[model samples]
Target: MNFEYSDRSKALQEKLTAFMQEHIYPLERAYDDFVHANEWQVFPELERLKQLAKDAGLWNLFLPEEYGEFSEGLTNLEYAPLAAIMGKVYWASQVFNCSAPDTGNMEVLAKYGTPEQQDKWLKPLMNGEIRSGFMMTEPEVASSDATNIATSIVRDGDEYVINGRKWWTTGAMNPNTKVFIVMGKTDPNAARHVQQSMIIVPADAEGLKILRPLRVFGTHESPEGHAEIELDNVRVPASNLLVGEGAGFKIAQGRLGPGRIHHCMRLIGAAERALEMMCKRVTQRSTFGKDLSQYSSIRQEIAKSRCEIEQARLLTLAAADKIDRFGIKEAKDLIAMIKIVVPQMACTVVDRAIQIHGGLGVCQDTPLAMFWIYGRSIRIADGPDEVHMYQLGRNTIKSFN
Candidate 1:
């Protein structure tokens, strides 16, 4: 397949590159400091950057033509490289209103929301006026198998009351997160796939409580905090359900296909940045009066990293192309393949980059450690590698049958 960027994409790429250089890259340390000083609250600078991004016309690059009322209306193929640029600076995506949980949640609303639902949630989200979260993982279940989720959403009178605990609800810790697209079983007696449903719950509803923030790799908070939450009989009108009762699994299948590709694109970007840093570091510093870049091992790593990144980028683009040509369901194998490949590639590249930098790589002085964390986190975030591999294998075998 031809993966060439169109003139429109190229021009947008130029603008995005300039924007990152002029505004985002310079604020890396400032963003860190602001986050560290705040007591689990969003940094004020985020809003300021959001306004700048909105003014500069870089907002909502993830929204598709069908779903976007106030966005660039770019498809997954068009949006991949732009997302790659944002991945270089971890916080940059939020500035453009294209970050995760929000992106996934927005897509769900756009694809499945009623017109009224779109007006209430999608409009404010697209405008960057409100934030959202997705609560599906449970603290007790091996959440990799979403069917194992035990959260319950039961209808009572005209409303549904949700009861369960969710961890790794990524954006829930943010005080500004105004709503949650929560997944829970609405019909335990229905068929396995049809037992669940997705409901939009107001984050401030009486029974919704943010119990505490969950840490990753011993780090208590990553600038964007992941959280554990207790939804104790949270009530929302029956009209808040996305598709319909017993449609949760269907919605998740559709939502995760796009989300996985976005993660792959961003991971490829992270690997690209890590490789750039590796080459720069090894060339500038000499070990025992010889250039580090001159070493055969370093040269091998550099060559290998180049190949790996290119392969991962191609795989991601192919997945995007498949999604565009066929429906997301038809593109499942391509999506799963890239989801398994991209994160591992980024982690390996970042690890080598870290080795090249000596101790400095693991330190906060450079982004290698953070990049590594992001890639490593992906192994667990969107269903672990093993789970996706299992599905891919089963799908492959099914085709032969």
Candidate 2:
């Protein structure tokens, strides 16, 4: 019930807010230009910013110590605001090594990897020496129900031979993405959720082909682009298996609790920025000798957006608090609720901004179009809205009974 951010979180927020202003916002154009020139390579300036964030004690703020001794020891509730701040700038998370795929992959390794696996992959990922991707969603299946993942990782002597096609494997296209955390069926006949396992495959392993970068509404999120890759007879040592056979579903479920929170928090940030853009644009432009903000309908739209953002932010905060206090399984309903809610909220907010900006909103001149695309993508990503809604409805009905 206490919604107040702790002093630690408050302090970090001020620091992160300042960091974003000084380093991130100022370089949005430079980062975009660098990536345009490099074509999907990591922005070199990000390395300089990464060092800056590290020096300011803003590194790895996403990993809570519940997994291991490696994190900054902040709880999910504690990290939510910082995530929201990072969310304001799309690329801000990586500078602090708090970005997706890597954060989730790092969590899995910290929680489940063997000591040797930790020393090999975990160390470098934590240090931000290399990047990684999670290969779970398949092009051939309804990945929303992760049980439908059809990849195969069969045992072959001391190594596991992985074969299948995975798409929307975010971060795979990055040159620094040296490893992948892949999920595939090891025992097809096992129980529904227990049939799969997670294994680590090196990016350079034989038979693994990263085909091409996929686009979100014709815009590729370059550098950390989503990739469709084929894993044919890809092999990795047995030691790379996370937890053990039949543990993929368990790991995936655990991965999502925090991941969903991060997504929802970032969505809030995106919506906030879009709303700001909309309000600013509306007031600055006018028709018939009246400011757009003075128009009753435009004011209503702005008010509606503000209300929606606050509602979604509160729900996201509740979900994060639930995960931190009650464990993810107990907080499933809340998590699912926000998963279904935040992206929709962001989409609506950004769409409003786009409408207000008219031609400029949809153009590359503003971040609205890109933010809107990201919002729409998440509606289908991380378990689609329909899936989450289905679960939430069932849970609600069961609760009333």
Model 2: per-residue Cα lDDT over 1-401, one tens digit each:
56898999999999999999998999977776677668778787888999999999999999875865898989899999899989887677899999998999998898888999999999999999999999999989988888899999999889899999999999988889999999999999999999999999999999999999998788678888999999988888888899999999999988888999998998899899999988889879989999899999998889999999999999989988888888899999999989988999999999999999989888777777778888899999888899998989998999999
**Which candidate leads the pack in lDDT?**
2
The residue pairs that clash in candidate 2, if any, are none
Cα shift from native, residue 386, model 2 (Å): 0.7
**Cα lDDT of model 2 overall?**
0.90
lDDT of 1 at 6: 76
TM-score of each: 0.97, 0.98
Return the TM-score for candidate 2, rounded to 2 decimals: 0.98
Q: Give per-residue CA lDDT, model 1, range 301-338, as digits (tens).
A: 99999999999999899999888778788898999999
lDDT of 1 at 219: 61
Q: Which candidate should be chosen as best, given TM-score against the real structure? A: 2
